[model samples]
Target: MTATAPLPDTAGLRSRFDAELANFLDRQDPDWPDGAPRGVFRTLHRFVLAGGKRLRPLFCYWGWRGAGGADGTPIVVAAAALELFHAFALIHDDIMDGSERRRGEPSVHQLFADLHARSAWRGDAGSYGRNTALLCGDLCAAWSDQMFHECGLSTDEVHQGYRIFSLMRTEVIAGQYLDLVSGVGDGSVASALTVIRMKAARYTVTRPLQIGAALAGAGADLMTALAAFGDPLGDAFQLRDDVLGVFGDPAVTGKSILDDLREGKRTVMMALARDSADRNQALRIKTLFGNPGLDADGAAELREIIVATGALDRIEQMIRVRTEAALAALEQAPVVPEAREVLAALAAEAVDRRL
Candidate 1:
């Protein structure tokens, strides 16, 4: 591979994105009485400004640049809008997955739950937290749409991009629903791959790239080329996430290693394990895989089973293959040289992560 240049001032780009988000939040006035209700927006402000990888916006930004779009406020605002959509996804995902932590802090719902309990509020604290977080997620989604539309792009440009953005939303929701059902249904590798493709692959990479390309008036051919480069990379990204969820340090990943095991997340790795386990191993897996009270010891045993069955090795190989495919496609993609280099670097960072 050719030596890739260092990515553009990513810190600078992140600072600008943060400023846009802050400015947007500052403009929001709930017009409600002061109390916990008003605090909702405050919490949202903190959540929005909180730390994130900002991968979607970076991808979108580069996508715009690759398609001959200039570096300007319009693209930055439009790209940053993706972060709001990402926040919306994460808040709701944490709620659905019953996750308590995010970015090394209490999840949006858990933050609200803790507040309710601390204040000795009436009713169920858990319910209140989930409800409030749902509203927050909804607000983020709405704000994402508003920001994208008001991103100072031409009317035609905004209109062109909205179609892809709208479709991306629908696809992600559908993917989430599929994930919900797949957990309870037969846990097949095919089912897991479907979930990954819909939930992570397209949503995380393909659509974001396409949306930026569309905003820059890219044609069908370039759109197809971006998908070719994005889809495999996105798959590898999710596969790495599944590995981290099971084997990563909580301190580094900002998530409990046992959560996926406890939640019975039917990942491709787990499916592979189940498929290859011996009878005794299968019995052990069936007994302990989804137990909500699973402790560290049980998690260790599950990890052993996964390793013994070669699931971890298989997943590692899959990630490697998909990443290679993505890079190869990117090399052949009809994009500018700067985008090609930055995107190659981004792909490596996205999949080759300890966190």
Candidate 2:
């Protein structure tokens, strides 16, 4: 008799998680009338399967493993649900930011807009595109909940997962609102950091870990340790993302260099630059930072300003410090051996990645 090979830790889990999504999408109910908008499902399938780091799911899976949950399919299914929720977030985020591209292709709204234009359908192509994408996002959110509820955990386990799930969804939406509100008034470093904590820190790492830990029925001590590790790592991750948004190669990052500056994202990097700029440099920034017509020259000038003010160096140092703190917390936590190693590696990647 031949023996089956053991699954390779997280990589195997990711592949299986992706396969679950594909299988679910492929098996959708065809009994629905032909009048049903099947194209929306198709579009969502492509969007969810397309390029992403799958960071949230990875954190979730590791969190489950770290909490002494036995290797099985249930945890993986739960983790994949986070990806669906993330799809909802990204779809709406692109529309909100008016982003043209994501993962090196037209964003969901942009894709719909292009389709409308090419097909010569409807009254207003842009509005149609936006509305269609909004529906798609809402569908993803609904699907996330559906997937979570159907994962076949025990009733108590499901209830636990739901608590984390509900709280996470609420926090991210509230964080996004905070982000939008910050754009209108004062663009201080403190406000930007607050946005980072709510939007990126908790949603990206902390709550996902907590959700997985909840699935395993982890104790308060373990949850606290995970939060201590996740908070700093997530903060560094968002800070690195801000840096990449402005300074990274478009080919490498698959995002426009000018989008954040154009949208006036009010990021920590920008806040630090504003804090340190001289009078004329400050005026130049005030004039060009949020200008819709900010061209390459303007972007280059902004980049130079950020660099000259030492904000980039300061932020880099902050990333290093936060990464060290996360690693330290991970070292002290009583997590399983393999999970500890994987999470430690992920911490470094989260703070120091190029894309």
lDDT of each: 0.91, 0.86
Off by over 4 Å in 2: 1-7, 29-33
- Which run of 10 residues does model 1 get worst, by summed lDDT? 1-10
What TM-score does candidate 1 reach?
A: 0.96
lDDT by residue for model 1 over 1-355, one digit each (tens)? 1213333576788888899888877777654445655767888889889888888998898888878777888888999999999999999999999989998899999999999999999999999999999999998999999999999999999988889999999999999999999998999999999999999888888899999999999999999999999999999999999999999989998989988999999899999999999999999999999999999999999999999999999999999999999999998888888888888988998999977
In candidate 2, what residue range of length 10 has the lowest lDDT sum? 1-10
lDDT tens digits, residue span 1-355, model 2: 1112332465666788898777656655564348887778889999888768878988887787788876667777888889999999998998998888888888899999999999999689999889999999998898888787777677788788679889989989999999999999689999999999988888888888888888888889999999999999899899999999999999988889999999989999999999999999999999999888999999999999999999999999988998898889989986777788889878877777889
**Per-residue lDDT value at 175 in model 1:** 98
Candidate 2 TM-score to native: 0.96
What shift in Å separates residue 292 of candidate 1 from its native position after superposition?
A: 0.5
Error of 1 at 154 (Å): 0.7
What does the lDDT read for residue 253 in candidate 2? 86
Model 1, runs deviating above 4 Å: 1-7, 29-36
Best by lDDT: 1
Model 2 Cα shift for residue 28 (angstroms): 2.8
